[model samples]
Target chain A: MDEHAHPSVMTFVAVWITLLFFTGLTVFAATLELGPFNAIVALGIATIKALLVVLFFMELHYSTALTKVIAIAAIFFFMLLAGLTLSDYLTRGWSTYPSTH
Target chain B: MPDSETVSNNLKHHFANLEQQTATSKFGMWLFLATEVMFFGGMFVSYLVYRLSYYNAWVAGSQTMEITLGATNTAVLICSSLTMVMAVHFAKLGKRKLTAIFLIATLVLGMTFLGIKGVEYYKHWVHHEVPGPNFHFEHEGNFDPRHVSIFFTLYFAMTGMHALHMVIGVGLLSWLLILNALERFSAEYNSPVEIVGLYWHFVDVIWIYLFPLLYLISHRHTG
Candidate 1:
């Protein structure tokens, strides 16, 4: 908090523009016939938007190292949670439940 | 009391300096937000699981989502995040009036988002999309209505929880507005504003993911 780089007004506005552009890009991407890639693209653009907000709008870029670690740890654990659950589900051969029942 | 003089400077007796105080407060807020990340992460994981299980219903359910409304709300929330950061900026710069103004703007934009969400909810209710005894999803032969009900259930659960966060954020902003009006924050002591900005921006971040996962699943043109 001491002598941290306070982002100028222009930076905030620039990030806003970038976020809006990405939002439009996601909507545009959804209209394309990309199959599974569409979901990837949507989530990819969303991750970019979330990163921008977290780093800039939330000022994590200017935060202390400890704070940055905490933030990153949160994402890491969330990934672990989702990854483990999905792995279990995706790798299962026996379908305990019917899809159309 | 000797502490009275220090208290007048807005520095708590336990903290060594204002810098330590600010950093500690921000650290605590970040910790709280970390837990919030986990809270919402569970919901997101559940969403992914169900989406994988019922891919068609998820996509079809998502298609029924009013992209126009969802996208509009995304933009509104983004604007609100901008205003929230601006509020933090003004608070740090000790510009009380600008801080209050930006906080109000954030509040207004947040409410606008919720209003759009309300309209979308009303539309769902009329269309019988609510997940209850009357829940009816108009789907083709490929997808199951029961799974579509699950989609709507997750949709409402995710976005409803999000809207609830927005409601709490609006209430926090109102409180900050009152404090701002009282001239409680200045350049040296604006932790409340900054911390609340973090919360508001986190809420915005949640919606950023929600928009795509729940609304933009599949919007390709069908002949």
Candidate 2:
């Protein structure tokens, strides 16, 4: 088999089970009071699950190098979108409302 | 390539061989999925900004979500993704019958997800949570209905856009199913099945994020 071939059945099943486990864990983590860490943990678990799907189920792991670059670019630009916007919102109050700050 | 015979019957003259054709098709699909990421990304950014401003309303609105149904749908969608990938594998192996079977299984699972979502929407409608003329949400901790409406508004927008994609997905699958029955697919010419599988998995990934953000926002029993 070529290095760029689809994953084995065992790999697919393992990834699926891992995804399900993370879903349950995220749900359970939400029940406890972890304060802000709760959101961080939930999103963290979700990012893990999403990475598994992208890498295996979507076959980006087995895809060509060019395909991999395009796929990674999507995430890079998405971060740019979120990071730049949040920077503005997080700093908007710093200049005008020092009393609240 | 022995598979070259199958390719010639179906391949367009534009491509050099089946391998090139498949790679090009997949590249295009990934490009489309990337744009989709940004499409859904806009709603997510707005939701985050509003959520930061009205954390209380997000909690109140989120608490009303049906976690049981949402969680079950998440599991169901993951199951569908597995089936979708299996379909692609079997298609690549030239096992047309098995490929069709798995495709059908994926379609069934996808519909089941949409059906559960419908039940959740019906419940929202019954509770006056639809965010329109009949919209009404009351809370004890001085939560404003306006801000709460904002939560449901984004909720519906994001999930509604997602559901629309699912609807389009099932339609795409149905077309593939028809083409399969017509014997339009082969190991070297199965780009349609493979490409649609990518689309199906992408939709599943969207729900992966949606499940927690929408349903499990604050499931604290004490609160």
Candidate 3:
């Protein structure tokens, strides 16, 4: 518990405000018909908001390099899960296979 | 006991020092959170596949959601995360009373979020939005009824799982509050508070993604 490492009250408040601002931005962006960009923009804002919470509120910013690596690894693996699975789903029709049914 | 003297008393026999013990506990929490990320990741990926396949139904189903309530719940969760971190800060500073106060504030905010979610659930129930035979969407003509029901299924499953996490978090905080009252934690040993803070913040992070992914899809055209 390093006293110097603790975040200031102002920092927490600022992060809170920023998270709220991003939440509003996501909702607003969703309302706009940006075609494919709508999901991208909404998720992009959400990722930023999640990053702020992770770094500040979760104190990952003050944590060690090992801790940072572990955190990033979690996200990386999750993306792998999403990406690999989506690839299979998206390309399922590219090759024909006999239906079990 | 004096604060300096208490530091040694707090050190576990298996750990070399307080720093190692704290780091180990934090690492354990991170590992648990990593598993949690995969747990929710599975659901989110399923959602993505279905959403892409049933784009119009997903959009129509998302439009039926009450954005105001969802946004308000997001704000509440964000504020709760703030209070939770402040509680950890105060606990580390050995300000027992402030730590307890902030923890209670977080608990109340968590309950408030759940209460709003309950209200939303009730509204859905009355509107026949729950996925089953009674399910009804005002925009049913625009998309397949089954796909729209699939959207609601994902909605309930995702948000319900999230709410369950919040409930568990509230329980954890309540126990922590009790421990704080018992003078169990001090500046020398606040790992429990810090670890729980990690968990609470992780839940908030999930909602940060869930808010947009579930509630904000195609809201402008539908609402």
Per-residue lDDT tens digits of candidate 1, residues B178-219?
Answer: 988877787777888999999999999999999999999989
Ranking by TM-score: 2, 1, 3
Q: Highest lDDT, which number?
A: 1
How much of the real interface does each model capture, measured as fnat?
A: 0.76, 0.55, 0.79
lDDT of 3 by residue, B1-223 (tens): 4556556767889999888998999999999999999999999998998887787888788877889999999999999999998999999888999999999999999999999999999999999999998997775455677888998999999999999999999999999999888787888888999999999999999998898898888775543
Docking class of 2: medium
Error of 1 at B44 (Å): 0.6
lDDT of 2 by residue, B130-207 (tens): 998999988666567788999999999989999999999999989988877777777768898988989998988888
For model 3, residues A1-101, the per-residue Cα lDDT tens digits are 35258679999999999998988888888777798898899889989999999999998898888888899999999999999987887788755321111
For this target, which candidate reaches the highest DockQ against the unseen true structure?
1
TM-score per candidate, in order? 0.94, 0.94, 0.93
- Looking at model 3, residue B54 earns an lDDT score of 82
Error of 3 at A73 (Å): 1.3
State the iRMSD of every prediction, in order shown: 2.4, 3.0, 4.8
Chain A vs. native, model 2, TM-score: 0.87
Residue B130 alpha-carbon offset, candidate 2, angstroms: 0.9
Q: What is the lDDT of residue A47 in candidate 3?
A: 91
- If both were scored by lDDT, which would come out higher, candidate 1 or candidate 2? 1
